[model samples]
Target: MKKLTNFTILSLFFFSGIMSSCKKDILETIPNDRVSSAIYWRTESDAIYGVNSVYSALDAVNLFVLDGVSDIGHTNTTFTVEFNIENGTYDASHSRIQTEWQNGFRGIFLANDVLANIDKITTTNTALLDRLKAETRVLRAYYYLKLTGLYGDVPLITNPITAAEGLSIARTSQADVYEFISTELAAASSALPASYPTAEKGRITKGAALALKARAHLWSGDFAQAAEAAKAVIDLNVYGLVDEYGKLFTYAMENSKEVVFDKQFLAGTLTHNSFAYMGPYSQRNSSSNFVPTKALADLYTMKNGKEITDPDAGFDPMQPYLNRDPRMRYTMYLDGDPLPSGILFKPVPGQGGADEVGKTQYNTSTGYSLKKYVVAEDLQTPGASGLNFILLRYAEVLLTYAEAKIELNQLDASVYDAINAIRTRPDVGLPELQAGLSQDELRKIVRRERTIELAFEGWRLFDIRRWKIGEQVMRGPVYGITYFENGNPVTIEVPSVTRVFDPAKHYIWPVPQKETALNPALGQNPGW
Candidate 1:
């Protein structure tokens, strides 16, 4: 698949999956030292460089077809005004989703070009032959999954077809997309290594393909199938939760048991380590993009406390975060001494204040900001710590199994044990589940556990969608306090969630304006 082509990177977008092309992207990123797509793939060395180019696309920005944007989702979670949808302040032309959409398709096309061309060329190194192809397929599948999930009914392109074919294709149903991913992942699982070589340890693995299948089935609501797929990796027994929940993402990255797949980042280099960028905007720091919302904050259950959702607990939802789930503290940036970052991010403990612009601002009105993915200790220009962005972890598979079993109404002692194993982690703050609880009770517990366990790993958006509550919860009140120092409490009312997600449209991003303006054959998503 090292063959360069006549097409640009976007040609890979619809290719086979999301990452259709690989080599062209590298040439473009390296500046004017241009390599025409039509000339390349000279030897094994060429293949190695070509594959490395493919790996280059897995950065924070490109990954946003899945992770929420740098500014909005990050800031929106905090109810911070980094990007405002209410004021029609959306930079639709430059949204990360748009970038993701374009990048994903570009990748798909590139993957197709490489995969199709590799077989045509002759190479004697049979050892690395299957390795490169296997990883490419895995990557293609990964990008397609991202695109399909974001914009339901995306065009399912399996090969690098001509411009005539590309321009006229219609959106395929999500069911078909899921089927494609399921099948591709299954095939790649066999071809891929259970783990990568030492130099290749960071690349795709058999475990990753299997885990992807598990997640795909989970999202598709194939609980029984999802459980079966997830159990395969769970049974492999190679992965388990990290001893400390907070250490899953670290400079050296200690927690690997559950991290099946991740985008590795090396600090002190020209790499994409955005812990500083995405984290809270503290006086001690710069800015916190994604904050934990009151709605999500409330997901944390209280310790030895009665249930608020229940009728007789005298539950005051106002004090939701207090005495609630331990995951709350780990997942959110709360008002405290030394937070998850451990750098003493006490932005507004007792004193409320204004910014340099003289407008009042507050640290998470719900007393919560994102702390999960923020690498707190590393703050030096090479300033932040090195950390890999975990794509899939064992904790998710465990929970997926538990949740699926619960849904199947066949949950047993093992299910509870699996869940408690995670709950028991010191990094995670919650206690064990109530013994012998009904399936319904188990359901509530799992939901709460997932909120704190996987809070900021880019799961909330999908969780809300799969749970089918995106409209209600995402459109509800994003609670916050705008404390100003006039000795008067300056409460800033956050606009409702309604502004962000339009029920009819706004699910998948609108096709990039340029694409539509050029291709008359292309149709926009329903709401667009």
Candidate 2:
């Protein structure tokens, strides 16, 4: 990723000028102090800053914490909007819901500003100009993807429009919105470079555009397009899975070859507090958040490539954490795991330790802390790590290809090779899938592999939604490891917050009431 410089400073000004908390229709006007199109979009540097400012809208907190809204996890804080969301108490009026709507459009507006004005800049470097334009278009498509994924249909504001004009635009059908995104991404993929130099790293590449196209097609159930798009990314050969899964999340691996697109961060200038959010209670200066439920913990397979419930797997409940997949220890903060403090993470009751889990102040309810993105050395500093939030990576491309093949009922040698590449990764060292499975069998395997591989990286919510299984897994008791009694792990079942996923309404968020009131043309979603 590029270092902090004029881009960071100018992005702050851009955000201050355009960001608003009111309804999307009337509150999206650009402030007078902001860089207006008339005078500001005349130079290459101006064009550069315009696109960089749009990247500021990508927040790690919102993107990464989305998994908690699914079955596998929950936000640590109670009585909050996220908690309400997990428990199915959220409505159109939730502040976070409104923020999602506002932020998604805010990014879109900024990208539109760049696209509308960049063409006016006098640049002899046509290649750079095309790349910049392609990058902006891909970002706009990404924001639209987020919007349509959360809200079934949304207002498709493609150009820079006045706030007054926006008030009269009605919602576009989700099919149309997705079609627009697909078209934009396809154009972007052609113009973008296959990769970028280190100095210009973290910019969108052709592979990222293709990967997103595959994601859109996959979610829309267009298996053929998804498979073809994913294959295009694979053919690029510019990216591959990192040698080790754990290294992919470290500061050393920022902008690594595996990352197609990421939210870049600099230590002193543009750092986020995700480590603090993912840390244990004692490690945190205040409240700890983002604990994993047992549902997630149990998804890891045995080292021998067998599920714990399989009778042939030699499962033992007394020593449940032992002999599990190597990825589990790297991904989760389990009891008896080594800590940076030269002690093990002992979450047993009355352990009098930082890792203790229970009803105490700042304690974890699920008896687990996220270790995937947490830097062990940064535990003392809490919110000081500059780890980048990886939005798209090569691993996802592989999984998308494998799943698309399975869905197409073309399960062949290529499908096995893709899934095995991840499973038998040098760091993982797990056994591969056996040969010659039926389409139905491989479909289950591929989905489970995605669950275990991408556990807390915030892809689970969309996966369940797209799979149409929200009611089955999301609406139930959220279980967690409680305490070890007589050397056996006891699972805690909390009845206070059983989730309820109403298939009728919970599949997509409702348009905020404030927006609907300000613009009567904007209608509410079903069962709001």
- Candidate maximizing lDDT: 2
The C-alpha stretches of model 1 lying farther than 4 A from their native spots are 1-32, 36-39, 59-94, 162-165, 283-285, 304-324, 339-343, 349-367, 382-385, 481-502, 506-509
Runs in model 2 with CA error above 4 Å? Answer: 1-6, 14-36, 486-489
Question: How much is 504 displaced in model 1, in angstroms?
Answer: 3.6
lDDT of 1: 0.61
| Highest TM-score against the true fold, candidate | 2
lDDT of 1 by residue, 1-528 (tens): 111211112222322232323465644442233443444555675565555445555545233223333112324432433345332244435455466678788778767766766664468776576777877787888888877777677778878788777677777788999998888888878877776545555677788888889888888899988889889988776787877775666654533666788765555432453555555555345344444544555555565434556566555444434665566666655554464434554444354422111123433433445655565455443235456677788889888888888889987887898788887776554567667899888998787677667766766566766786655655534554334455555433454443355556644556656666666556677756
User: What C-alpha lDDT values do all the predictions have?
Assistant: 0.61, 0.81
Tell how far residue 485 is off in model 1, in angstroms: 13
**Residue 223, model 2, lDDT:** 88
Q: How far is candidate 1 from the true structure (C-alpha RMSD, Å)?
A: 6.5
